[model samples]
Target: MYSFLQVLWFVLIAVLWTGYLTLEGFGLGSGMLLRRVARTDKERGAISKAIGPHWDGNEVWLLTAGGATFAAFPEWYATMFSGMYLALALILIALIVRICAIEWRKMVNSTKWRNVWDWAHTVSSWLVPLLFGVAFANLVQGMAIEVVDPSNPMTGVGPENVDLSVHVHNLTGGFFSLLTPFTLLGGVMLTAIFLSHGSLFLAMKLTDEMRERATKMATNTSIVSTGLTAIWALWAQFAFGGSQPLAWIPLAIAAILLIVSTAMTLTGRVRSAFFASFLGIAAAVAFIFTVMAPNVMKSSIHPAYSLTLWDASSSYATLSIMTVVAIILVPIVLAYTVWAYYVFRARISVEDVTPSGLLPYKIRAGENFLTAN
Candidate 1:
């Protein structure tokens, strides 16, 4: 049986991931929709401003989740990272480029400069969530893991130096091994959900023509998102849920909420739709972690090689110290996040957005670039 600290840490890690997905989903979605939904430069600026105040803050949850996982499950972290090194590196690169694009978008007055940054932002936004979806799906579906006996000198660890009883579970699959039909479906499902969530957010936070466009987009995407979510959730639960029958509870809730979100979007209830999508995302993330508990990483090679929460956890003393630190810091983070959202709760419009860059420029039909006040 696992200790209370081990189980508690697992739940806490899940909460962190839920927070990240719930908050950042719309931000990434907005980035993806930047060019598609907004025709004019001013319209694009409004979309960026809508998410600007919270996007960077929202990323903190992801950082915290990674830190917690490293401290609480060192062995799981090591093995998963070793197997997923290339994928993770790509994700990191995409995130870095997206951040730079968002931050540097208004650094120049030229239209070409902003256009290049917008394209970068849109591509990276799409890549990050799709890659994350694939990663999470692999967690549920299991990986190619094999147990290595140190007693065998051929296994790399010298028999004379290492204990014979110590065996390590290592992931033997390469990057190509991660791609499969089910995992690809998972990636598309996540991307669609984010698109709907973002459109709903824009519908709530914009006015006039932009709002109408966003609402129409939300209504259409929500339907697609609902259908895909149903297929993916059912597939994940039935195919890879193992002995955890109770995992169906959160999965059911996620499906229900997503349906409600779709209905709300269809009826032009922007605020309700956005809130439902937010909660639905959180519930979906909860289901993923729920189905993955006990076994942090399932081994496809053999049942005995699966890494359980207890087998991968830190020492009791280490957990005790970390728990103390988390208890003091978590609440503070929550309070500030809530406060920031409340402060930036006002709606935006195209007319409300001023010209971007220190010296904004306009191009006439026959003239060269001209500075605009």
Candidate 2:
């Protein structure tokens, strides 16, 4: 049996991932829709401003989730990172580019510069979700993993003084092995859901023409996402969820919520639609964690080789220390996040977007740097 701390940390890690994806989903979706919903530069600026105050803050959850996984389950982290090195590198690079684009888009005066960064932002935003979906789908479906003795020279372990009784589960598949049809569908499903989520958020946070456009987009995307989610969730549950039959509860809840969100969007209930999508995403993530219980990493080579929660967890003393620290910090972080959102809760429009770029800031001969226009 897994220790109490092990189970607690597993649940906590799942919560962290759920928080990151649900919070960042709308921002990423908004970035992808940057060129789709906004026609003019000012309109695009308005959309950017809608998510600007919260996007960076939202990333903290992802960082925390990664850290938690590393500390709580070092072995699982090692295997996963080593296995998905190339894919993770691509994701990191895309995220860096997206961050740069968001921060520097208005720093230059040239329209060409802004346009290039805008496209970069959109592409990176789309890539992150796609890769994440693929990664998570692979986790649910199992991977090419095998247990190897450390004494085996061919397995990269030195024979000298090695413990033959202990074995490590390592991923053997190359990067291309991650691109099965189901995983690809998972990527597309995530993209569609985020698009709908972002459109709904924009509908609630924008005014006038932008609001109407966002509403229309949300309705269409939500319908598409709902359909895709139904297929994906059902496939995941039916094919790989025999071990955890009760996981169907959250899966069913997620599907029903998506349907309701679509209906709400169609009926002009923008705020309700956004909330439903948020809950739907959360439920879907819950379902994923539920299905993945008992085993942190499922090995396709053999059932006995799979890494269970106890096999992957940290020492009991380390978990105890981490638990204490988390109890003190998690609530504070959550409170601050809620307050920040509340402070920035205002609708925006094209008129609200002021002239951006360096050309808009000119200094007269007598004006100091601080007083410049």
Candidate 3:
């Protein structure tokens, strides 16, 4: 039962992660595509329409993941939240900027105001996932947290023990640090993969010239993203010593599908490409997660401070209660979320931004979005 629950919790975590990646992946991706699409007002409006109505709601998956982590893995929540506060703060700042771009868009009409929001949204959207990619790369690489009693305050132990009074052993990346060029480069690759994934989404949700433009963009984005992912996966395994020789097989499959999906999208298989890109990204993330399994954070400071699945899991009773609640509530949440998406699945158009639309009458439409296209 304990193992079963652990697996369930992991699955839930994966679902939550996938949800955020798919939803916010495109928000960031769509925003990243803005520079390319911004040649004209119609193109810009189409991008806006592509991402509108759903960006903020998409973020709730992150919130839900955090809440689940607290409930199911309190030890992890405490240790990482406390230890990684600095990185988390910057991540939070990016989140705030991303949210503000959506919220503040309605407050102005001038080109300057809209441009400011555009830049904010674009940059924040790009950085958010890059941060995750970096963090995930570091996580899979492992850490240096000590396995000693947590109650004992002073605990940064290394084999060649250097005891700095501070609990956090390192702030900046080290030469031997897991945040190596390969890892950071993987983050960059992830950013591109998500951008391509998002372009497919835009292809599905938009129409007329914009849809055609997105479909064209999706083809190129797929080519580039797949190429980069291929290069990164090879580098990660062979050169960087991340070889799970079999691991590359699934990623290879995902890469093939990415190419095929692009072909499909360009050939008027919009729905196929949309769904295929979803599969492609899911497969890719799964590949990464599989490679990174059993570690959420690694100690750059020293090997002893490393946090792993065994040390970081919550006590049995706590996990039990959380499991019970999740088993009961998660299905309901999934049901409702699916229903809501289906109900709102229609592609948002320029018309929806006008008065009398579902979101326009709301109290908090994005301020930049209020400006005419």
Candidate 4:
């Protein structure tokens, strides 16, 4: 039973992370492409139109991840979130900007409004991954926390809730031993992953001249990402001692895929390259999780406040109920998500965003919907 809980715990983390990478991957990709679009408002509008239909739906993965964390690993949630409140708040705000930029950008007739959205979209899009990387980097690196011992020190809010012993300060407080080279490496790694993920998304969405540009960008980003991740892995394994030998195995597999995918993109096999990038990111994310598994959050303040999977999980009955409920509804959620993506598959069109000269009935005719084949 304990073992089962552990499995559920790990799987939940994997699913949430995977869902995040898959869903947001395209938005990042599209944003990068759109940022490179010709200066003309019309061209940028086409870029926006391409990504607008699916951006909001993609963010649902975050909600799913958060809900799962709340249910499956409530303790970790409380500690990390509460301690990291300010950073999380900034993230939520950035999410708002990214979503609003996507939604409101083309809804207006004025180029000025569209331009504003464009900046918001680009800045927020890039910042999301960087800030997220920082947060995760902080976690992997651990935080400073003050502990409350119940028996000896007899500290804590109450008997049932003694885990709230530690506190997380600002994103990077003035604590003497705050910064670590390893943590920065983690952040850089995350940035590389997201950038590469975004590149593949561009290749998948656009075609023709724009598509060719995307292909090139994807190739470049994947190559750099592969190299940087490899270097970082070596550093982590040897200098930082952050990752274990076993963890390097999946990471090695990911590296192989990363190289293959980069080569595919270089050869102009866009679809194949796209898949390879996806596979590589998946493997790397898994490798990082596996490497950082046992300690969700360690602390410089006190060892007692440090949290682990076993110490932070929900009860047996709760896990059982969650497992059953997730078994049923999770599939439906996934199906709806998949169906929506399939229904909207192919490249986005400029016509979709622009109101035609004709009435609504004629607009629904077969001519406007152009899928990127």
lDDT of 1 by residue, 1-373 (tens): 2399999999999999988998899999999899888998888888888998998899999999999999999888988988899999999999999898887877767778878988999999999989999999998888877666645523633323333148776787789878888888989999999999999988888889888899999988999999999999899999999578988999989988999999988887889988989999989988988888889998766667678888889999888898999999999989999999999999999988766586546555665444434
| Candidate 4 C-alpha error for residue 272, in Å | 0.9
lDDT of 4 by residue, 1-373 (tens): 9767766766777777777776686676567556774346666676776667777777777887788778877877877787677767888998898888877775545667778888888878777776676666566556765444435443333323445434221212333333467666665666677677666676676556666666677777877877877887666556423445677787788889988988887888878877887777777767766666675666655445567677667788888888888889878878987898788777854444463212222234455533311
What's the distance in Å from true for residue 230, model 3? 1.9
- In model 1, how large is the Cα lDDT of residue 222? 98
Query: What TM-score, computed on C-alpha atoms, does each candidate reach?
Result: 0.92, 0.93, 0.80, 0.83
In model 2, which runs have C-alpha deviations exceeding 4 angstroms? 153-165, 358-373
Checking candidate 1 for backbone clashes, the offending pairs are: none
Model 3 per-residue lDDT tens digits across residues 256-353: 77777777866878789777777777767666656554554555455455554555566678778887787898788778667767876787554545
lDDT of residue 110 for candidate 4: 66
- In candidate 4, how many Å is residue 369 off? 30
Please report, in order, the local distance difference test score of every candidate based on alpha carbons: 0.87, 0.87, 0.68, 0.68
Clash totals for all models, in order? 0, 0, 22, 1
Q: Model 1, residue 139: what's the lDDT? A: 89
**C-alpha lDDT (0 to 100) for residue 172 of candidate 2:** 81
Best by TM-score: 2
